[model samples]
Target: MVFFNLWSVLQWYLRPFIKWFLRKTTRLCELQRICYGDKPGAERSRNVEKSLMLSRTRDVKQVVSYLDNTVLERSFVPRNFPEILNPSVAIILRAKKINPKLHELFIVSFRRCLAQIWSYRLLLEEVEEMRKTHYDSSLPEHEEKLLKLWSLLVPNEDLESRVTKQWQYIGFQGDDPKTDFRGMGLLGLENLLFFASEYPQASSHVLSHSHHPKYGYTYAVVGINLTSMAYYLLKDGSAKTYMFNARQYLPNMNLFHKFYCYLFYEFDKMWIESKPENMMEFSIIFKKFENAIRNELADPASVFRINIEVDTI
Candidate 1:
């Protein structure tokens, strides 16, 4: 601990001098070094985010604040990218004493990183808002979505009544599934619906696994539990590596849903493979599972993809 503490203090003091020396020798600012040295995606984007946040220059710092303000201002519209980020990039270039005409690629790539970083922030707010909204039985839209989920997962059987025990067929705690969504809210429902809709066969396969008598578990209930896990991964920024490295180029609601699907699908697999004594072992296994995911996310190159083949309807 003492050795690490001393190293931290020493690095804090020498960081600026080291950056200055590197800049003098390479004739490149720290941002340029990261932007040019690293390949596109999470590693470059993550490093640029750190460099901007730690920068001493006011204009460089404004680049960070400007992107943030734009996100809060609801300016994540794709058409607004150049308008919102270009000025900030120009300001940063001037502050760093870089010739705009010479390093056009750096300006372009830096702007992309700014977009990726702030868009993820905006997406976090959007997801948290969705998670905070409690499921409402009286709301028609909410009711409709609930019904849609049932229809997607259990296609053959029709729900007899709104408050019937049929919900247990798909693994609700009681007659109604609304209360089960308390912690994750509608986000839980969204994740399940997306999985059933987008990758029907995969979800069906997992749903079938949930019914293994010796390995049986509540499907919808366990999905909500996985939803909580997905929220934590996003809330703490562990999802950034996967999000930024994704081919989507922007983190959005559907991407979040896909993330939740990945977790639910994978957790089902883990539960079966672990072959636990019973449901009492869920909490311990889930914690171990989450730790494994965190380790994977710590790698900047990590891009999570499930091996399931999407079955066509």
Candidate 2:
């Protein structure tokens, strides 16, 4: 037992040295490739070297932009890079080795990259999980909760009605509302339920906007679309800036749901304020809104929040 304990202690102490050695060896090999320019993959290695050098000199936005335009667009890092580097500790070690003078910039850039990778992995796993989880109507609890959510959203409507075009008022695809949830599965329902249940006033307010004869859009469809937009932002690494600026750390589902709520409220305002001629313009309008959001996220200090004071509907 004592011998085993001693071995464990030795291993623990040696871990950092081992990691440093590995990184040093990798750096040396990359430098050698860049110097020799003979190997087929040398050019890629040279790019990585250039990236490292640029990371040292560039500001946070520049580094993030470079990464977004280049590294993230391609498959430069493996999916498990975050686990290997562990972002926080990796930043310290990286700063020490790369350029201590630019430690602040290094940490910021490293953290943003780390956040992007981690957030993307989380989003992919979440989306796949949601896709697998079909909404089972047979479960009484699920049915009851879903109906309860409906009641909350449309208090005046009769709950016992089997089918009605009234469902269209809230943006479901058909008389049977379950079909509308087919693409997003239970996740979509849960997000809507959360919005309605947690912020009943806000949810009902948005529903009213959906009823507008001129500029209104489908409530549920728009909600699902916003979910897709949120997922896209998360998956593509754009949300990293927002998440990083908001928390300076990786975000969990709670934060994600809050972001969804913000989108729900904000998109309603955008739709009303822009006053599109018809529903056919939703794609163009949504793209414009997305670009506006991307520009806001480009700022390092930007933080998204749910403003309770914003007038409902």
Candidate achieving the largest lDDT: 1
Candidate 1, number of clashes: 0
The candidate 1 region of ten consecutive residues with least summed lDDT is 304-313
Q: What does candidate 2 score on TM?
A: 0.61
RMSD of 2: 14.8
User: Backbone collision count in every prediction?
Assistant: 0, 0
TM-score, prediction 1? 0.95
- TM for every model, in the order presented, reads 0.95, 0.61
Per-residue accuracy of model 1 over 1-313 as CA lDDT, tens digit each:
9999999999888999999999999999999999999988889999998888888887777677777887788887679987877787778888999998999999888888888888899998888889999999989999999999899889999999999999987889999999899989989898888988988888888888888989889999998988888888899888998889985568888888888888877888788999989999989888988988889999998888767463431
Q: Tens digits of per-residue lDDT for model 2 on 1-313? A: 9999999899767755764585577753232233233222213222333444434323433434544443334332446445544444344344445553534444444445454444545555665576557777787866776787778898888655746677776788788777877777777777788888877888888888888989888999889888877777776756655554454445556556667788888889899999999999999989988888888766545678877665353
Choose the strongest candidate by TM-score.
1
Task: Give candidate 1's error at residue 162 in angstroms.
Answer: 0.7
Q: After superposition, how far is residue 233 of candidate 1 from its true place, in Å?
A: 1.0
